[model samples]
Target: MPIHNADIAAIFEEIADLLEIQDANPFRVRAYRNAARTIGEYGREVAGLLANGEKLPKLPGIGADLAAKIEEIATTGRCRFLEQLRSQLPPTITQLLHIPGLGPKRVKMLYDSLQVQTLDQLARAAQAGRIRELPGFGEKTERAILEAIRAHASQERRYSIALATQYAEALIAHLRRAPGVKQAVVAGSYRRAKETVGDLDILVTARQGRPVMEHLMTYDEIADVLSHGDTRSSVVLRSGIQVDVRVLPPESYGAALHYFTGSKPHNIAIRKLGQERGLKINEYGVFRGDERIAGETEESVFAAVGLPWIPPELREDRGEIEAARAGRLPKLVELKDLRGDLHVHSKASDGRHGLRELAEEARRRGFQYLAITDHSPRLAVTHGLDAKRLSRQMDEIDRLNEELEDIRLLKGIEVDILEDGSLDLPDDVLGRLDLVVAAVHSHFNLPREQQTTRILRAMDHPHFTLLAHPSGREIGGRPPMDVDMERIIRHARERGCYLELNAQPERLDLTDLYCQMAKAEGVLVAIDSDAHTLLDFDHLRFGIGQARRGWLTAKDVLNTRTINTLLPLLKRTM
Candidate 1:
């Protein structure tokens, strides 16, 4: 079986989790975690490189020992160290880490004190009121744990769009290689660019069905095949992502794509329009009293119902059909529109690359500018910069600007929004920078009113420029902090600051709804890749997908403007 980057990353992540739970050396645990991130986001397949007798390229956190381990996993498909760690503890205890507030330390404490090793065990302890009696956990924390447990139990397993893309793209490319295959595309929610996808729906037009199905069954990563037939097959990948592939004739391909690439409500609305027009629309074809009329292309299907083609991101039955009818559909923002990334980091903080390397990559991406917003002093874990260090960094930026060509680097800091609603860096220091990206690094559990007020107060600072990762939610890891988002969006409009649509896979913050809300209030949304490494810029495509879903056009985004136009806007906010 072939090993992909995600597979290797998962192994390293598990090693880190188990080591942390055992109270192992913090730096050792951190090394594995960092290696996992670097490999996971790497643009090429490490396994493939090794297979071709090519050396693994030098990465930031992967040293000699880690490189050997990567070779071990790539060649043998298992990590012996991880297996040994699993033997030393109840393997299931790692699942406890999935709960929002439960870190490895808390899990270790719970196990040592009460012998709690599973969700059911933890739930029983909480229900019996024993968890509150523990030293660190009180009634409020106990209640939140119980609630998180319930939510975790009820939730369906889903993959982040980034991870799903890896599996989907590889499979589609494989299918396209089969003889007689014409078109292959992944439809459904993945096509709609949802943050999470449950499964994949692939539609292919082929000269013959049997050869395509045979090629699919031979896919190296297949864990199990659920069904197989002449025209359709269903299989689950080793990563636990289910995929259904259907082979169709060229004539009915478009109608089938439209039907399968759907939000159920949107399909119903289109069908209703077909009904009123005395036509029948479905996966097979568009028919008028049993005679097929329009099924050759998606545009023809839409024309049959008297509407223009709708972008897949907007086909959620969210007033898109009506807008298409009125010819008011937006020219949704594309990836090419972005001029630069606003919230980025460097080795001075937690980031991987140096200033010149980051600039070279940004220039290669055709960006006019890239802001280097390293962390402020409050996040000492990241080796965040103090005022004196920040000034020195600013001076460095001035020198780089004089020597660099095409790409200009902006000086900035991701200053923490402190608990008392103050910026972490003093106002005098903040005033000297080109931009100040205010963020909430800690205190994620404050009351709704306090949280909102804290952010609002931070935005009011004279030097505040943009709000980074507004909600501070990690897709499956942490619940979004409780705050009044509407009030925040309106306040950004009033204060002339912008909200970030963070493009990191886990933290696609300022969700589609919030983006729409900001647009309604005449506030620009900066679709930024809060990139810690060079490869992280690829995440901008995910942000663009999210922006289109929110009905954002090029004009609604902050970073779409060139440096000449954007610097003026940043000055107004400052």
Candidate 2:
């Protein structure tokens, strides 16, 4: 089996979890976690690198030993250290870590006290009222664990866009290399750039002699082949994501893409339009009484219905068809439209890179500016900066800006929004920066009313410039906090403040709906990376996807403006 970067990352994460449960050294545990992150986010496949006899690039927190482990997993599809750790622990123990409120320590305590090794065991303990009797696991924590386990059992598995991309892009490349292949593309929600994808729909066009099904079945990552046919096949990857591949003739390529890329409602609406015109539309082509009218391309398919080509991101049947009919579809924001990133960090806080290195990397990516928004002091786990440290970092940013040529560093902070809604740093400190990116790092369980009020109060601060990751969601791991997002957006509009569409894979906060809501409210969003490492800057593309899905245009994005225009907007909040 060909081990993907994600596969290796998963092994490392499992190792980290097991080690943490064993009460291993904290630094050692952190190293494995960090290595997993770097490998998962890396653009290239580790196996490909190894195959080409290239040395893995030195990543932060990845020492020589951890690098060796990565190579082992990449080449052998297994890690010896992880296997050893698993031998010492129950296999189901790691699953406990997936429960939202259960950390390694809590799992360890439960196991020691009640011999809990699985969700079932934990649930029984909680129901028996034994969990609350444990030292750290009180009634509240016990109830939360039960709720998380229930939610986990009920929810369908969904992969984050970033992780799914790693799998989909790799498979697409693999298919393109097959003999007689003409075109290969991933359709469905993956093509639409959804924040989470349920599965992959792959469409391919090939010559008559091609062996597409054979090639797909041979993919190294295939965990099981669900079904196989000459023109269509379905398989499950080792990562648990199901993939369906279909082979079509060149003539029906566009129609097949449209059918597979559908939000079912959107396709139904288009088919109804065809029906009105006395035409039949299906995956193969659009026809008028058995005479094919359009099928070669998506544009033709749309034109057959007297509509323009709707961007795939806007194909949610959410007024997109109407807009297409009226010729008023938005020119959605693209990755290239961004001029800078407003939510970046450096080693001054929890970030991996130094100021100069981050600036050079941003400049290398053609960005004109990058903001260093390190965490404020309340987040002591990250060594977040105090006022004195923030002031010093501001001076450092000014000096670096003068020394650099193309990229300018903006002084900023990802200041914690206190429980009562006050800014982490004082106004005097916040006012000196180019922008202040405020975020709520704690108290995620506050009641909806209290959470909404907390954020609104934070926005009222004189120096508040932007709200970062406004929803505080962690994708599959944690749910969004209970808060009134509409109220928050309205407050932002009134106070001249901005909201952020944080691009980090796990926290693509301010979801597509919220993005649309902000757009409707006349509020501009900063599609920021919230980067903690140099590689994190690449996350902006994910943010752009979320923005496009929300029907955002360049004018609706804040950082799409030049530094001069952005500066005045920031000043207004100050």
Candidate 3:
């Protein structure tokens, strides 16, 4: 890998610390630290120049003095000064730098005060009364330290979709009821209905003028007021959630909406185009020499800039504007396009409803078909089906299909992928079901190389019609298991196995980029809601927008087909 600015700057800083402890030349020590900071804040990667054999000194922060030190370090595995420092302190002490309040100065204090190294040791020393005895430490200080450590350890990798949705719902509802509020919406990444949301953004129009800003701060849940002004205000909620509310004039509502609902890259690209056309873009309005030209609404912002209206999800500035400019945007699929739900549960496994009840509900939603996919036997907690139960579920599906109206029920199983690259359900058992969704429920932390091979092997199994939520990620709780999405999607396409765009907000797997790429590669995707409860069925809207972000259309999705047309694909012979 080429050395990025951060990568080089970090190494340089290490050199500086080592020099201090090594008792090396003073100027040499200062040069490394100074250069490291300068390069780090440069805002771009320097890896590109390394490939071209450009000397380091040519880059910012690399003066002749610093350049010599870099050359010496790169040529030898051991930096002479660093080696000396390594002998004096336990290397693990460096990790204390990761804690927000505990910088190197505080780290040195903790070391001298209690000789603590790792987080566990530090937490213990603080708790055992050694830390609070120090000159600057006290009960409140120790408590803060303890909380920081706990927070760091439990730093959520992602937020659950449900949690984000709840916050958005409350904020939107509250703002809508606020006096003078004409229209309010949860915009930004949340508005796009993303699987994992980072923040909650609220946009509103106010008729009562500047006083509306004061009313917003009155809510009891709002605290840690960040910034409050006429046009904008922000506060951190008690739940550790940040809510940003922007008040817009009704006339500039659309323009303000477009600016706030940003995919930064998309915004950058649009602004670049505006600059080229002698126009300016901002939240106030898109302007020509201070005379407001367009931006009454989001639609006009795009029209003013000579482009078609782009959806919020596609605003990521990731080829979306180009696609819009070319009029080649994918005819995105919608919730109405979904003809059936391919991965659903019933009383056969852990589902709340029974087989007949599930089918009837699907029919009620105007679905032409519904697949009752229960967990296989390995998932014991879910009442996973055995050979006998699988046979019964299939027979029940047949019986129910005979009694149903326009809709038909498909029998399927979500079989576990075993460590040995085999499905939990045997070939004989799998052969009986109309469809099979193979998933990985255990051994999530397997190395990427092994996990990819493992899932690909299961997909190669003739019975696996679809790979369910291939990443196995739950919003904010866990990172996706290390599997190559591009590799897995390609393997499934080659084997004629569909990849599921699981509609569950927490697991909108095969994200927008993967969705578009998969379509380009001729892979058939199933927009399965993976609905467990009746209300969870509403997640279809998020999935549809996600699919459209990937540029999917009704024709590109497998589940959008009528039940009659879907049956043949479920069989092994097809």
Q: Pick the candidate with the highest lDDT.
A: 1
Flag clash pairs in model 3: 158-476, 159-476, 254-296, 254-297, 254-298, 266-317
Candidate 1 to truth, TM = 0.98
Q: Residue 356 CA error for candidate 2 (Å)?
A: 1.2
> What TM-score number comes out for model 3?
0.72
lDDT per residue, candidate 2, 317-404, as tens digits? 9999999999999999999999999998887877888999999998898888888999999988788999999999999888878889
lDDT of 1: 0.94
Best by TM-score: 1
- Candidate order by lDDT, highest to lowest? 1, 2, 3
Better of 1 and 2 by lDDT: 1
Rate residue 452 of model 1 by lDDT: 96
- For 447-510, candidate 1 gives per-residue lDDT tens digits of 9999999999999999999999999999999889999999999999999999999999898888
Poorly placed runs, candidate 1 (over 4 Å)? none
Better of 1 and 3 by lDDT: 1
Write the number of the candidate with greater TM-score, choosing between 2 and 3.
2
Q: What is the C-alpha lDDT of each candidate?
A: 0.94, 0.90, 0.76
